[model samples]
Target: MSVPSGLPQDTPVAGGEQRVLRFSIAATAVVAALGIVFGLMSGSYAIVFDGIYSLADGATSLVALLVVNLIAGYNASGSQNRRLAEKFTMGFWHLEPMVLGATGLLLSGAAVYAFINAIGSFLTGGRPLQFGQAIVYAIATVLISLGMAWYGRRANRHLRSELVAMDIRGWLMSAAITAALLVAFIVGLAIQGTSLEWMSPYVDPAVLALVCLVIFPIPLGVVRRALEEILLVTPTALKQHVDAVAQAVVERHGFLSHRAYVAKVGRGRQIELYFIAPAGWPARTLEEWDALRDEIGEAIGDDSPDRWLTIAFTTDREWAE
Candidate 1:
């Protein structure tokens, strides 16, 4: 199967594995649009704040889509095609740092702006939300948030994409904020439905704090990933799986003198280990080595734009490294 733009659709992806990704993409766009509408209609500073958050989330979806495309690797037409494809698969690695810093700044600015605006409104005699309009908006916001969370969790299960999981968290928090507002609305609606309404304006800070809390992790994750990639640390999970594969080869082949080194390259795995066997296997020895290479490729080769190349070498026992 292939995605329309000539991209490889056969490979499995976190969100792109079938039509699940289409659900996520469509959901993101809908949520963002709804958020903007509610923000404008209710004058609920919290909702407006969430609207900005939603915009960022929309941008994140765009970035994720780009990443998915890169991993799919449908466009290659030159001598550097392979290299470019690999780099594209690894694009998320490079994009994270820059995206993190910018998102941090944007979120911080928005929080500060909202807080200032809210305080200014409060100083000028905090205005109360129009019950009918605000209640409808809150309900819509809450429903959207909840829907996003559900979709995000589903996407996480399907795609195993960390970014999609993060999106779920973002949506969950947005939903929670809206849920809180819904409660406040109910409480106000109960206390003469508008006679007691200080809580509505007060909750913005709490929600704003939540937004900051959410933004805090994005940069940290980016930094952690960057550090690992920079230090060339093989991801423990991938390394362990590779080791198991290599060790099995050794055990099965009865090779006594073999050294193994494995590293991760983008989504593809790399094996840089050497194995040595006795020179007496005759024609069978070469056959075994060739079989090993093929095995390594089949077992762990992603061959995606974001794949790692696992290289295995074999030599006579005396020549083993």
Candidate 2:
């Protein structure tokens, strides 16, 4: 959606570029279901674990989808004024990443469990694994990984969506894991009659576990960051940026002192900012008010060290003197 008007006191801003997140949501959901089905059908433990993690990814994707809709101005049929009224009531889209982050943590924990079982298998000689299944799984893994990497980066290009970029990394890691499984499985099968049967099976789970341990951190970090925002925790640098932007308007444009506080919403290249403006900034008349709005948009314009953004500006008529 186009950026919202640059007023914060009363208006709401939309955020999060649609390309990166929407693609991810659809892709992950499909892959999650595929992984679950294939894993269960083939009786592949590693694949089963992959399915579980994929399901978690699906959950996050669903969240991203919702957040994207919110930011993209998803609304029921209505006129501009009616749509704006709804927008004003809903505020901005800020909770998408929170859902993603939490889901990532759940996947990480599950990966840990998968990892432990892999190591534990040294005693049981590892479980019987289908070498052919490894190939199929790997193929799917690579396709999904490449697709995600492409879209995730594409999203970053358009909206600077680090979350989407993060998704790319996750998918790449999954592909790598599957590739390792395929290679190891094939090699072990070749040497099965000799001295590598035990080793072959062991290798698959060991590698899977190792991959899980390595890949799990990505989502965990995402989750932690998501929680911070969801819980009203603000980063020092972000707080500084908000404060700086607001203070600059006051100092340069003669806005009321300490009269505005701005907070950034959304993730990635798309940012939505909410701020207060002094009522007495020569905006007494209707035309002056409209001019003030234009001034705010130009001042904070999507050029505030951001590629895509929505900065909502609102006059503090009731509070500011």
lDDT (10s digit) by residue, model 1, range 1-321: 011122344365632533444565566567667656775775566666666666776676566556555545435455565677565543334443344344445545665676666566656655455445656767876787788678668656756654556566666766776676667656655665365555655544444455455454454554455456545676788767766776777788776555655554333334455666655655657676567677765675454444434344445543335
Q: What is the lDDT of residue 302 in candidate 2?
A: 55
Clashes of 1: 8
For model 1, the run of ten residues with the poorest summed lDDT:
1-10
Point out the worst 10-residue segment of candidate 2 by lDDT: 5-14
lDDT of 1: 0.57
Give me the candidate number with maximum TM-score.
2
Name the top lDDT candidate. Answer: 2
lDDT on C-alpha atoms for all candidate structures: 0.57, 0.61
Give a tens-digit lDDT track for model 2, residues 110-169: 888888887787557776666666668768777887777776676566555545666667
Score every model by TM-score.
0.67, 0.70
lDDT, model 1, position 41: 77
Per candidate, the number of residue pairs that clash is 8, 12
What is candidate 1's TM-score against the reference? 0.67
